[model samples]
Target: MTTITTRTVEYPADGLTMIGHLALPAGVDRRPAVLLGPEGMGLSDVERRRADALAELGYIALAFDLHGGRYLGDPEEMLARCLPLLADPDRMRGIGHAALDVLRTEPRTDPDRIAAVGYGTGGAVGLELGRGGVSLRAIGTVNATTTGRPGEAAHIRCPVWAGVGSEDPIMPPEQRNAFTAEMQAAGVDWRLTVYGGALHAFHHPPVGHPVVPGVGYHPRHAQRAWRDVVDLLAECLPVTEDLGA
Candidate 1:
């Protein structure tokens, strides 16, 4: 059976209680911990599965909820709620730091090896944390469009890996190019992977979305993205024999 734990964490920012799923590999001590920021729809089953998968890899993964507890099936409604949160940069950064703190404080987690992974809007929030000097070992984002231009990219201390779809309408080629250019100019160590023919939220399975025609599930890209994430974490957060299996 999968070895994991679950609990609720109260966000001190807004007194919001976020359900967090903590997954750890058995027979591991003081493993690196990853703070997972869910996509715009909030913490769904997919995010929980991701936590479990990461745990299997011997990392303590904590999936934190950005939304209080509301899961809206309608795309428009989800966007309505998500957009406002993104608009306030301060609030977004606050939430990201709070989530990071929760993961760092976990008894099973190694504070020095902490990292973060986020989806969509959550990706932007993770970028903000990096920019704010959160001291993370690495940060990975999926279908995210919130990182600032290259001028400010120099502020990011941790390595960042971003995954995007070639056909994503929200983040087109020009924007991706600009982001790449900025990262290059800032001298930040980063990598951008473009999956062919994938759309926004490609990792998420089909669901109702009035703005988009197809659902957000691309199995090939999703699997590849997960692999890249694990690889990045392993590289950035090295495990000593005491911490490794």
Candidate 2:
């Protein structure tokens, strides 16, 4: 097994002190990196582990925070915080930029070689960063087919991959269509994958008491989505051995 190291990071955003998790592979030089975004609830162990896994795969990773380092176990609280943030593109971009800056400032990160992968609200943040003209190598999002302001998507320069459950009521066909239309209008290289028989938040494991309606865990599809994200990274932002030399 490859040696990986991790640490907690703190930064400011949205009038809150955001706490992030950074993961690094054992190496001596700069390497490809990924900006990982967590679900609307906030930064949790799941995202931290994902960051570690990416580091083990030979990439530096930062799992950024939302909600001021607090995990919103109540659906109402999560929606209350995320809904407004999602509605404002500038705010979302600010959050993403703050996290990206942390990653870029890390000595082990290759500034020119980076990707963004996010889940739920975090995914929306990834899309916003792309729309804000960040030079990401790739963008991957799950359950985040939210569309941004008109004409904003044209700024995206990297390929995008998005996945959602077919039965996701929150991201119904209309939402998906709108998101795809924006991508097409922007001439972005984009792909969407809808996993059958899955629900919203299907990639997430069961957590907290009284799970939200219309959200359920699908272990099989969750694994499949992870694999898809990994494949996207491999194809668009491969880390060569020379990067660590």
Candidate 3:
């Protein structure tokens, strides 16, 4: 593994002191960056490690926060906060922009060459950033297939890739269809992958905390989803040549 550096950063968004994790590659050269977001439960070790992994691969990664430095393990609390946030595109864009600013301002980041990849509600934020015309190279999301307001998707200027479990109750067929329809109508390049027989949050590792009814972990599908995300980044934003390896 490459020698990557990590740090804890604090930024303000959603009227809270958001805490995020930043990982930088070995060299001092500017590299393509990624804005990574966590599930609605908040920024946990899972996202931190993901940032580190991206760093090792020579990308500057920032795992953005959702709940102002707190991880909401209780199912009800997570829903209470995430539900409303998910409903509002502006709110989602707020969180994404704050993190994007932090990522763009970093010394090791090439601001023009960037992407957004997120999980769960974090995934929704990535889409919102695309919808808000952020000039992202690509947008990759998992377990979040939410559709934005009518006519808003036309603003997205890049390709998007989404992954979801076939049996996911939260992101059922209707919602997926709606999302795809919007993407197509807007002439946006998009693709969807459905993991057979997996439930909601299938990409998430098994957690000890209380979870909602349709949430479960699928080990194999989770790995596949991650690889797909990496592939998307490699295609849209290459970092190998600038890694100084």
Candidate 4:
């Protein structure tokens, strides 16, 4: 049977309760852990499923909430809620650090082998964490757009893997190119994958929506992106004896 734990953690700074879904591999003393930042919609069932999926791969996954318990399927509403947080880099970094601390403090989590993964605006948050001098083993982002300010990438000390859809209108090709260039100039280890014909939120195949005209989900790319995420996590996280057996 799969072993998983779910709990809600409160942020003292904001007095907001953030739901956390934790999954641990059975019989492990300390396992590598991942800090999962939810998309603009906050901690939804989709994010919970992703955490469960990660547990199946022998890693302790912690999915965090950015907007408390509020979630909306509308893109405009999500943007309105997340834009303010995104505008203030310091506040965004604080949230990431807070979540990281919670994940690292878990009894079953290995502090040294911690990584972060995020989607959409949460991806930008994860990137900022790396740029804010967070000692992460690796970072993965899906359909992220906002690159950091000048010299921001210089502080990142870990490898970053960004997955984007070529056909995504929200994140244009020029922006992605510029972001990659900044990463290269900053001497940060990074990888970018552009999936042709894929749309925004490609990894969220279960969330059916027609947010943008002529843009929908792509199952093939979604599956591929998920596999890529698992592979990246396995590469960055330390191997445990339980998983080795």
Q: lDDT tens digits, residues 1-245, model 4?
A: 56665655655323466656666666647888888888776778888888888877777888887876667678688778788878877877887887887888888888888899999877888999988998899999998856787898999888899999998887789989988998999998899999899977777755654364434578999889888888888777756554666
Q: For each candidate in the order shown, give its overall lDDT on alpha carbons.
A: 0.78, 0.93, 0.94, 0.80
For model 4, give the 10-residue run with minimal summed lDDT.
Answer: 206-215
Spell out the clash pairs found in candidate 2: none
Q: Which pairs clash in the backbone of model 1?
A: 150-182
Poorest 10 consecutive residues of model 1 by lDDT?
207-216
What is the full ranking by TM-score, best candidate first? 3, 2, 4, 1
Ranking by lDDT: 3, 2, 4, 1
Residue-wise C-alpha lDDT for candidate 3, range 1-245, written one tens digit per residue: 79999999999999999999999988788999999999999999999999999998889999999999999999999999999999999999999999999998898899999999999999999999999989999999998999998898999998999999999999999999999999999999999999999999898898988999999999999999999999999999988689434
Q: Compared with the true structure, what per-residue lDDT tens digits does model 1 show for residues 114-140?
A: 888889877888887877767888989
Better structure of 1 and 4 per TM-score: 4
lDDT of 1 at 89: 66
lDDT of 2 by residue, 176-220 (tens): 999999999999999999999889989999996665678999999
- Residue 107 CA displacement from its true place in model 4, Å: 1.2
Number of the top-ranking candidate, with TM-score as the measure: 3
Displacement of the residue 58 alpha carbon in candidate 1, Å: 0.9
TM-score of each: 0.90, 0.97, 0.98, 0.91
- Per-residue error (Å), model 4, residue 86: 2.1
Model 3 pairs whose backbones collide? none
Give the clash count for each candidate.
Answer: 1, 0, 0, 0
